[model samples]
Target: MIEIYTDGASSGNPGPGGYGVVLKAGKHYKELSGGFRKTTNNRMELLAVIKGLEALKTPSHVTIWSDSKYVVDAVEKKWVFGWVKKEFKGKKNKDLWIEFLKLYKIHQIKFVWIKGHNNHPENERCDQLAVAASKDKANIGIDHFYESEQAKETLF
Candidate 1:
């Protein structure tokens, strides 16, 4: 079984954002993180899980540990499936959710919600990685979909 711990942070709701992930399988371990110039905490939260899952090279039993209810509850409570039937109308993060479902089908996945900033070792490490990524200026990347969507919103 593979275990993944993830966390996300943003300076503001739609400001600089980042996600952190720690993946462990037996004795092998890996850490992943990325930053976006403009995004949301929830986006980063979901993206952290996506990124972690994407890193897996094969289908396996995976358990995801997350601090965000937005990510955990949506899956655990089966709300995302309902959203899919509606074609994600009136929903945010459609792009990410679609990507997640693609991965969701390929692996046997489970989610465990944890309290954030509670001194859990892996969770704290993920939080540190996320915060550092969000503050890193040189490697920051653009979240194209989010930025374009924001632009369209401003035009209306």
Candidate 2:
């Protein structure tokens, strides 16, 4: 069984943000993280899970631990599927969601929610990684969809 721990952070609601993931399969462990210049915390949260799953080279039984209720609850509660059935219209993070669904179908995934900042070692480490990445301006990349959406909103 593969266990993945994830966390996401944002300096501002719509500011620099990043996601952190820790994947462990037996004794092997891996950490992944990236930042975006402009994005919401929720996007980062969802992206963390997506990245973890994407990193897997083959289908496997996977359990995802996330501090984001938005990500965990959405899947555990089946809200994401409802949105998908509606074609994701009027939904935020449609791009990421679409990508998530693609990889998601390739593996058996389980979502678990862990309370944030509760002294959980792995979760704390993930939070630290996410915060550090969010503050690293040099390595951060543009969140294209978010930037384009902002541009479109400003034009009207």
Top-lDDT structure, candidate number: 1
Q: Model 1 scores what on Cα lDDT?
A: 0.97
Best by TM-score: 1
lDDT of 2 at 68: 93
RMSD of 1: 0.5
For residues 72-123, could you state the per-residue lDDT of candidate 2 as single tens digits? 9888899999999999988899999999989889999998899999999989
Clashing pairs in 1: none
Candidate 1's residue-wise lDDT over 1-156, tens digit each? 999999999999999999999999999999999999999999999999999999999998999999999999999999999999999999999999999999999999999999999999999999999999998999999999899999999999
